[model samples]
Target: MVELNVLVADLRAESAEIDALVGGLSADDWATPTPAAGWTVAHQVAHLAWTDRQALLAINDEAAFRAELAAITVPPERMDELVDAAAAEGAAQPPAELLAGWRRGRDDLAEILERAPDDTKLPWYGPPMSAASMVTARLMETWAHGYDIADALGVLREPTARLRHVAHIAVRTRDFAYLVRGEQPPAEQFRVELTGPDGEVWTWGPADADQRVTGPALDLCLLATQRINRADTALVTAGPDADAWLDIAQAFAGPPGDGRDAGSRERERRTPA
Candidate 1:
């Protein structure tokens, strides 16, 4: 089992970094569009701040969290408006104050996680998961949204070799494979090999694994989370699950994303004639 402390340290550093990035931005920059579908920079930060707070509330009050979770499935327009409203509120405060408040929320979350018992049960929007899993989910959320912020600014944010954190979630998205098939999930662990920055490749699962696959961690993360298409990158597969991953690979424990296969057409357009 991974140490919860490692996760806390990473998040503490990233949250502060994220706050500074948002705090330094001008009003125009706040309104600038991010690569994340239909979200502005403010929306991105607001979601993070809101989510961190929600996790805290969920940890202490599962019933209230479950009730609120039900509203997440409401009409798309309503959800959009809700998120937009949160962004507006976040952006309304002074930069330093906003940053201070955001840091406070995340730090408080870290404290809650520190004291969380090993067997603690957390309520998830998708399914019931452990407190540890919730912490991982928070890390996953930070990376994904931070990717969006960096992309819009044309800056490359390098998370230390700890991408193993996000990659683990991506690899575990095996069940999401079944959702694409429109069938029940199969009880099996698929092998995954993902190469990270500096050409370090990480492998999960047994060496003699039947369903072999190898690829860049970026592609794997993007694909599993439906941020990019399998065909859009150099990911290779040599077993039965190859085709399945191509069809669907979602990491977040929820309904499939609308962004899947987004870059496929552009990817094909860039191919040689």
Candidate 2:
């Protein structure tokens, strides 16, 4: 098992950075098109805020929390108008307001984490989550939504070093593989090696195990989080479960997202060989 304290600290730091990067963005950049189909940069940010609000409810009020989920699962026909409204509401506020609220939300989350005693049962996507899993999910969201905004703005955002939380999530999503294929990992360990930003690298599990995945952290995170596809991306997976695992990698809460369309690869070609 991974260390909970280290994972949470990494999440908090990355979340702070994501807040700073987005805070400095131009208005037009925030409204640009993202890898998320039909979602603008504002929509991506709003989704992060919206997800945080849900996680807050999970830790605070269970009844209120479960009831509130319909809002996310149900696809609204008026998504464009709703996103426009959220952006208008968020953008209209002064930069200080956005920063203050974002900071408050992150702080509140961190506080909840601090209060957990490692034995605490937290609400999670599949089954109850340890406090560490919850924090990892938070970090994954920070990296993911940050990228949507960064890519849309035509600037680079590097969360490669901050991706152990996400890489952890990906490796643990083995059950999703059972859903895709009928079998699961054969009672053996797997290894994951990711090359992070600025020469930093992250490796998880044991090498020379039943399964191993190695790649640039950016591409691995993108593939594991379902933000990109295996066919076009540069990630390499070796072992019995690799191909099946890659077919349906999910690292977040809620229903499986369609992600990038299969036949029509958009960002992969432009991502360099």
Instruction: Give the best candidate by TM-score.
Output: 1
lDDT of 2 by residue, 41-119 (tens): 6666666665576578888897777665445543543343554556556655555566567677778878888678979
Q: Name the best candidate (by lDDT).
A: 1
**Candidate 2: where is the Cα deviation over 4 Å?**
1-3, 69-99, 180-189, 197-211, 261-273
Give candidate 1 misplaced runs (Cα > 4 Å): 70-98, 186-188, 260-273
lDDT of 1 by residue, 1-273 (tens): 787777777667766666656767877787777766667776777778888888888888878887887767666324545666777778676655666667788889988997788888887655677777877878777777776666565555554565677888877767655764476764555678888877998988877777777877877776765666565778888676655665677776545566644464243233221
lDDT of 1 at 55: 86
